[model samples]
Target: MKSVQVFAPATVANVVCGYDILGFAVDAPGDEVTMRLTSTPGIRISKITGDDGRLPLDPAKNTVSASVQHYLNALGQPSLGIDIELHKKMPIGSGLGSSSASTVAGLFAINTLLDNPLTTMDLVPFAMKGEELACGHGHADNVAPALLGGFVLIRSYEPLDIIKLPFPEDMCVAIVYPEVDVPTRDARQIIRSKVQLKDAVTQWGNVAGLVSGLFMKDYALIGRSMVDVLVEPARSILIPDFYQLRELALAQGGIGFGISGSGPSVFALTKDPETAKRITNTLQQHLQKIGIRSLSFVSSVNQQGPVVIG
Candidate 1:
């Protein structure tokens, strides 16, 4: 194939309990990237859209292009030429894994055009370079699910261990992106370097319970275990009316509600699509009442990750 276009779904990282170890893909509000092979011997960014001119044009600086470069270098094919075009459909620094979607889309597209030179698992580390550039942390909580789809658990980081867990097919995710900018790096900085052993134990148990609940399709257990006593306590203060929103979601039949990744974008899970829509409306309307303009979507989990379009 001379060219390929891929759509990578937006992802929710942490999910209240898992932090940097878990995430899942959503259907709408993703990134689109197109890659075309060229005879010249280097990657280039020919066009970009929807980034408000804030993103870089140079291949070396852009997340999608930088990931493409890393993928090529890892395959010992840096001399090959490729042109990239990025369309950022989601807001940046909204805790929605915007950069990860773009990075995964570019890497997935290029790999497809190259006739599947790398396996899906092999793409994580290469795509992480983009995360490192964008957020200064080579974390896979966002990118892994965006690349592999469904619910992803990062079992280990030393050897890049990941597990794709089964998700309830009918469950829906409700997300509201308030018009606020909270960079992942800044949100991460507010976290303390140390935690009490008691809190650590509680967090571990909650994470374990969350995993089991997800696998067993136990919605009640999942909701109970979605508590984030560690990170949320510190980060929730950064988001306006965070606790009130969580309370509203839970009252409106949401299974659980919490900050999506870092902050400024919150998500809630519901057992069915109707409940998800109601929660979305409730959240968006509440935000509007508070004079905060927002964007909201209700979608089932996206199991297909990234797909080739053209």
Candidate 2:
């Protein structure tokens, strides 16, 4: 194939208690990339849409092309002629892995056009280069799930040991993205570097419980384990009416509720699609009532990570 277009799903990272370690993909909101081989040598970002001119077009600076460049360099073809077009279908800075979707889409598209020179897992490190460029942290919480789909746990970052965890089949997610700015870089700065030993112990227990609950298909256990004592306390202040939103989600029968990644966007876990929709509607309504513009989505966990659209 001379050209390929691919779609990558948006992901919810730092799923409450499992900060920098857990994430899962959503179906609807994502990004697309179109890449084609050219006679000219070197990567070129031909165009970018849906970013409102906020994203860079330079191949060296943009996450999509930069990540693709990393993949090419790894294969010892850094001078290969290529052109990329990024289509951002999701809102950037919404705490929903916007950059990851675009980056994954770009990497997947280029790899597919090259006739699959690398496995899906092999593309992850290249994708992380994009994350590093976008947020200054080479964290895999978002990119991992966006590439592999489903729920992922980062067992180790040094060796890049990723564990795909099982989740209840009926689990659905209700996401609400308030149209506010919560840049990942700025949000990461507000996180506490050191935590009390008690909080760390509690967080560890919750992470363990959450993993166990997923494996056991225990909804109640998952709900109880979604508590975050380490990062949320410090970051919740950045979100408007964060506690009130959590209260509303729980009262509406959500299994668990918390900020999606950093702030401005929040999500609730539900057992059924109906509950997911209801929670999203309720959250959007509340945000509207409070004079905050918002976007909401309801999706079952995405099992397919990236797909060739054309």
- Residue-pair clashes per candidate: 0, 0
Residue lDDT tens for model 2, 1-310? 2998899999999899999999999887999999999999999998999999999998889999899898999899989999888899999999999999999999999889888999999998999999999999999999999999999999999999998899998899999998988888899999978889999999999999999999999999999999999999888898888999999999999999999888679999999999999998888899899999999999999997999988
lDDT of 1 by residue, 1-310 (tens): 3888899999999999898999999998799999999998899899989989999998889999888888888889987888888999998888999999999999999899989988988999988899999999999999999999989999999988999998788879999888877888899999999999999899989999999999999999999999988999988888878998999999999999999999789999999889988988998889899999898888899998999977
Give every collision pair in model 2: none
Candidate 2 residue-pair clash tally: 0
Which parts of model 2 have CA positions greater than 4 angstroms off? none
TM-score of 2: 0.98
Off by over 4 Å in 1: none
